[model samples]
Target: MAIILAITNSKGGVGKTTTCANLGAALSAAGKAVLLVDNDPQGDLTKVMRSDPKSLKYTLANLMNAVLDDTEPELFVNRAVIEGAGIHYIPANSKLAGVSSRLVALQMSSRYRGGETGGTPCELVMARVLELFQSQYDYILIDCGHSMDLLTINALAAAHQAIVPVQAHYLAMEDMADTLEVIQTIRQGINPKLAVGGILLTMYQGRTNLCRGIQDEIQADYGNAFTVFSSPIDFSIRVAEHPIGAASIFAYEPNNPAAKAYSAVAQEVLSYGQK
Candidate 1:
């Protein structure tokens, strides 16, 4: 079975998609079969993986439609996956924005018709779709949209764990309490098996005292609840340019500090899985 992990944060520009792309690449480089799922409507992860969302004939939206129709998941799972950068992924585009509304309509219709115990709700659809691929990959990484919407909740419901990438700044650290509360709520109500993989510090600058202070504060506040990774992703121009080159940091510049840092974090993740 795959260990499904969601890379998510409520705030944008915190490197959630970047971490998902690099971590999937690094894990694949370690000889693990990886599937990166773009759960965000923005399609940033899809573009970074060298896929053009506009040209894709099939996408995650199609799979969600099939799930809503109660079709066999196996019949449509492979058709939505695009292979690139040593991993398989289901791309998402703006069309995915309608899925949540459709799911809500389905629930309403079920209530009116008294059909089949309301079927599967919107929040559990992603979990059902991912169940089809549990044995096919070693890791399934979901790159979530930067919000606490139905889509993000579906990702959380489907995941075995979550990796929160927080920028090393005072404001970002202050917003983390709410994000952790949401995760805790999901674990309690939807997925009891969901664990916090770790808290990763991104866009870190060692030269800045403010960055160091925020890192120390995060450890002191949440270290008992979740593991805070020691290897912080440093600020790098190469990382920003990775998507344009259609590659991960490990592939774009193997010797880069950000690449090495992600590799170390991947090893830490592997060790956690072993335990």
Candidate 2:
């Protein structure tokens, strides 16, 4: 079985998508089979993976709708793009926005119908679809949008673990609780096996007092309650300079500080399986 992970944060600009792509790339470089799922309507992950979301013939939305419509999802499994980066992925597009809206409508209808009419609860749609391809990879990293809508809920419901990436800033640190609360809620009701993989501090500047202060504060606040990765991804222009469909950071610039940082984090993540 794959270790399905959701890279989620309710706050945008927190490097959620970047972390999703880089971490999956790091894992793939370490010889792990990785499948990246673009759960956001923005398709940033898809774009980063070197595919045009709008031009793709199939997507995460199509697969989810198929699961709900009782169509065989296996047909879509083979369509995962085997990018040059060595990470396979399912892309998403603006159509995912429609799927998100439909999930909400389904939830409302299910409430009124007492859950008798819906085939799958809105929160479990992604779970149902991911189950079809879980065993094919060692890790499935889901890049969730910056909202706690049904789409995020579905991602949480499907995930075995969550990697909450927060920018290394005081204001961004404040939003950690909200993201963790969502994970706790999902664990309580939807997916009991779900756990926090760790809290990753991104865009970190080690020399800056502000970033360092916030990092220490986050460690103090969440260290006991959750795992705060010892390695923080350094802020770098190279990270943002990765062109579409380029091999991961390791492939883009193997010696970049951010790449080294992500490689360390991947080791930490791999340690979890040992424990």
Candidate 3:
């Protein structure tokens, strides 16, 4: 079985997609078969993986549609996946915005009609879909939308673990509390096996007092509660530029500080998952 992980933060601009792209690449480089799932409507992770949303013939939207329509899982799974940059992925686009509604409607209809007991729930849609590929990949990383919507809920419900990429800033820390609360809620009701893989501090600047203070505060508050990764991803122009170039940091600038940090984080993830 694959270790399914959701790279998510309720706050936007917290480097969630960037972490997913780079970390997936780093894991792939380490010889792990990785599948990156773009769960955001923006398709940033898809683009970073070098797949254009406009050019994509199939996406998460199509897969979800197939799942709800009772189509064969293999057909949509094969059609939606695209391989690139040493990884495979199911891309997402703006059409994914409608998935939440469709899922909700399915749930309501199931309740009203007293549907079959084995039917998948709204929150487990992604989980059910990904199970078809579990034997094919070692790690499945989901880049989630920046919200506690149905999409993010599906990602959390599907994941065995979650990696939260928090920017070293006060507002990001504040937003993290909400994210953690939602994770706790999901664990309590939806996925009891889900665990927080780690809290990754991103865009960290060692010289900045504000960054240091924020990091210190996070460690003080969450250190005992979760594993805050030792190597904070440093603020790097190289990291920011890679997405625009449709490449991962490892591929664009392997020696960059941010790249090394992500590599270390991937190793940590692998080690921790083993436990």
Candidate 4:
């Protein structure tokens, strides 16, 4: 079965996209067939995959648009094959940002919306993707946009797990409650198999009491949500300036402590649902 994880943090700059890309890379490197779904409308993950989408043929937006056509769903998805890394990426674009409103527009114009058994069109798009593509991947990692809107809901509905990346900042911690509430609601109704994959503490420093305090508070609230996540991503320029398609910390500096941390988390995720 494909292990689908939605990498999201309601707060931005918390390493969600980085985690998704790198985890996809790491898992693919470990001989797993990984499919990375760039669900972020910002197109950051897509930029990371293609470095530049200007030259790409079809993006996630196109794929979603093609859902209405009579074609194999994968035909619409861009299968970006990274050399030596058994990975596939379904790239997104800035155009994806308007998807929600367009979907809402669909609701207002379609008779389906007025029906008794009507449902959100956004929710169905990803379910179709999963039914068609999940079998081809050992892991499908969805890199969500920075909001709990329709796209995130669609991603959450299609995935089995969610990995929330949080930074060691006071304000960032506040968003955790709302995000978790959304997760709880999704789990209760939409996707019963969904669970908190883990809470990753990013931008951390062991020397700060602030880091420890935040970790403690989170654990207190969610019962030690992170079992094997890394300490902090640290203040590294390399992490920020890496070229598109370049390997993340795992490939750039696998020996680094931060890389080791992400690898540990990757290992934990790999062990999920195992006997």
lDDT of 2 by residue, 18-63 (tens): 9998999899989999999999999998888888788988888888
TM-score of each: 0.94, 0.96, 0.94, 0.88
What digit string (tens of lDDT, one per residue) describes model 3 on residues 1-275?
89999998899999999999889988999999999999998899888877789888799888877776777767878889998858899999888888878877877777887864355777888988899889999999999988888889999999999999999989888889899999999999999999899999999999999999988898899999998999999998879786455568877678899999999999999897467
User: Per-residue lDDT for 82-197 in model 1, tens only?
Assistant: 88868889998887888877866766776777665455776799999999889999999999988888888899999998999999988887557778889999999999999899
Query: What do the candidate models score in CA lDDT, each in turn?
Result: 0.88, 0.88, 0.88, 0.73
Error of 3 at 26 (Å): 0.8
User: What TM value does model 2 have?
Assistant: 0.96
Best by TM-score: 2
Residue 255's lDDT in candidate 1: 92
Clash count per candidate: 0, 1, 0, 0
What local lDDT score does residue 225 receive in model 4, on the 0 to 100 scale?
55
Model 3, C-alpha of 187: deviation from truth (Å): 0.4
Q: Give the winner by TM-score: 2 or 4.
A: 2
Better of 2 and 3 by TM-score: 2
lDDT of 4 at 268: 75
